[model samples]
Target: MRLIEKVWFNSHPAKYLLVPLLLPLSGLFWLLSTLRRLSFKVGLARSVKLTKPVIVVGNIGVGGNGKTPVVIYLVELSRSLGLTPGVISRGYGGQAPHYPYLVTAESTAVEAGDEPVLIQQRCQVAVAVGSDRIASAELLIAQGCDIIISDDGLQHYRLERDLELIVVDGQRLFGNGLLLPAGPLREGQWRLSTSDLVIYNGKKAKKNANQPLTMTLAATEVANVQSGQCIKLLDFIKLNPSVNAIAGIGAPQRFFDTLKTNKFNVKKQQSFVDHHSFTLADFSDFDDTIALIMTEKDAVKCQGFCQSHWWYLPVDATFSDVDRALLTDKIKALL
Candidate 1:
């Protein structure tokens, strides 16, 4: 783990010792953030409202709170509602030839980011990547998308959103509950009160005034990266007695724990930083004898360099029927 990540997520005395030093910076960040939001609220800064309503799926803290799966589920729900939906992202770690790049199934992760390409590949919906969320949404609208889903843009005030959905990590709610440079929160804990919905990505618990809905990422199937053949999780585990698991996500332990839950004999494990670009050279230590398993997010980036033994397990976001109905009602109200 990176040094800052270690400090931010740390729960022991060491983190407490260092947090005091960062409190001043965190206070400054809060001030700037509040000022920026006030600028939009007071008309000092402009927030563009598109023709179609926007649903933003984001988190208050850094690191992954399983927002991607929720975004995918939202896309499916949008289609089921008979509304053509498109996605817009900040294109984190992606450097395309130009701005507002539309992602396709064949698009490389390096070109349009790992999450956008994965969403396009899985959801089969139009996705645009750019720093300017408004421009990206415009591109999606030009492609006939009637609604927009902004991935990880809750704090982005420039693009006005009708529905704000805040996702939180159930295991670690807000780490130390301090602001940036001191704790995991990008915004203060009070920000949760303003969200229309709060979804916990793991074990659910009552927090403050909001009764959070629960969402779980369930492994559905495993597919061969080169052959495109899929098999049941049990069948794949039975077939591969020993394989090395590789993950380049925000939380590698979560993916690893999922593999263990499915009874996979993980002979070895490798974890990379979130959105780490990969090449064949990185896998040189592993021979062709053992298979290399990865998450669907990592698989998108490695598709360019074909690997015969490389495989990725696909997962779906699952929620209770009550939560599903409530979410559906909320979206339908917008339409």
Candidate 2:
């Protein structure tokens, strides 16, 4: 992680002292964001147009609004629309691809990032990861991609987008309703107002929204790692009624809640900062035999050092036809 990101989340009171600096930092961010938006407004930095259209699946929350499944849905939706789509991601925890580079199934999570690799495996779409998202889009285009679908980038002003979809956790909505160091918002609420459309997986969209989409994942899916195969969700419940659950996501409880909904016998839960690089010590204090279920994002980092009885339940989201029509119409209006 970058030094800045590391310090931004430190909960020490001394870090709170840095909030004053956040005033200038936030102002500068807003200024840069404003100037970039103006450039698009006046057509200074031209947005590269795709032959088909571009759809971005993202949210303002720092993490975990079920963005991955949404991206997968876009891949399938594009195919259904008879468009060949390519996916772009910033590769937050993966190797830093200085510019856009194509991802492959053999790509390691450490090299290409887990989410992008998972997307590649699930949708069989061209996947690229880099900081310069616009350049990545061009790379995908050069390879004959008809449309571009960016994962987790609504505020990436560099990438000009045709359609925008925001996924908000029904529970968090907006954490503390503050921006940046003060809270979890990457951009303000008004950004949603200006977006082409909004989708609330667990949250409701504004009443004035021209269109809205809602999606939910299946109760469970198979977890594949190591040589271990086909562990039933019920198996965990029957064996450990007072087991501990650990998660490192924007909302760890969300994962825990899903497990409970599936009738897991969880008796305690541990929440880690999102993208936490787990250490051996993290598991030392836990009951050695208790099952450890984690999100796929976290599983990327955990796979190598995982202890006993570890598994990650993969999730897939489903959207209704009505919501699909609304989303398609919004993209059509922009295209």
Candidate 3:
């Protein structure tokens, strides 16, 4: 974890000094965010409502709280319901040639953001990437999509949404419970009350009306990053008991933990900043004989220069039967 992240999520002694120093900036962030949201709410700023309903799957905090997996799950659910769903992303860490670029099979993580490309590849759904989400949504709509899914735009009040789903990291639920700079949240915890649903990405706490849903990421297989050959996770683990693992996601530890849970003897686990652009040199030190494993999100970015021994674990979001029915019913209502 980075120093600031340690200060935010871990019990670092720096928190005693850093929190006080960053509290003023957090207050400023709260003020600006509150004003921006209120402007849309009070009609001071215009919020464009699209022809189709938009389901925003996002989180209040900044780090990876498993929002992308939830978005992917929703896309699959929409397909199961026979509704055409498209995804729109801000394309962070990407420099596209044009505005509202439509993701194609040839799309690279450099052209479109990693998450959008991952979604497009895994779900085979229309994905639009750009800073102007409204424009991106319009592009998706033009492609005959019946519904839209915003990847991580909880604070982008410019585009009006029909439903808001806030994902929370059940393990580190709102570290310090303070706003950005001082902590990890973009908005306060109270924002959860106003959201349509609160989905926990890990072992959920005592269930109540406020947090009725939980999601688990289930990993079943590992695929060769270069050849696209698939193998059962256990089969691969049995052959290679000790391996190297790396993750470039919002919460790298979560990916590491998942590997550990699956009984992979992780010899060397490395964590990189989220959406890190990987180069061939990044893995120069890793032993080639031992398999190198990574999260699918990081795998998407490494495919261009990946080695034969490199593999990626793909995880799917799973819910209990009751929660699945509840979610299905809620989505059906949207139709």
Give the winner by TM-score.
3
Runs of candidate 2 with Cα error greater than 4 angstroms are: 1-25, 96-98, 239-242, 328-335
Model-by-model lDDT, in order?
A: 0.88, 0.73, 0.91
Tens-digit lDDT string for candidate 2 (115-175): 8877886678999999878888888988888888999878776666788888877666765
Cα lDDT of model 3 by residue, 1-335, tens digit: 78999988896899999999999999999899989888888989999999999999889998689999999999999989999999999988888999989999899999998999999999999999998999999999999999999999998989889988889998888888889999999998888878888899897743542545889999999999999999998899998989999999989999999999999999998999999999999998899999999999999999888999999999999999988888888888887
With a 3 Å backbone cut-off (N, CA, C), the pairs that clash in candidate 3 are: none
Question: What clash count goes with each model?
Answer: 0, 2, 0
- The number of the candidate with the highest lDDT is 3
Write the residue-wise lDDT of candidate 1 on 148-185 in tens digits: 99999988999999888988888767877888988889
C-alpha-based local distance difference test score of model 3: 0.91
Better of 1 and 3 by lDDT: 3
Candidate ordering by lDDT (highest first): 3, 1, 2
TM-scores of the models, in the given order?
0.96, 0.83, 0.98
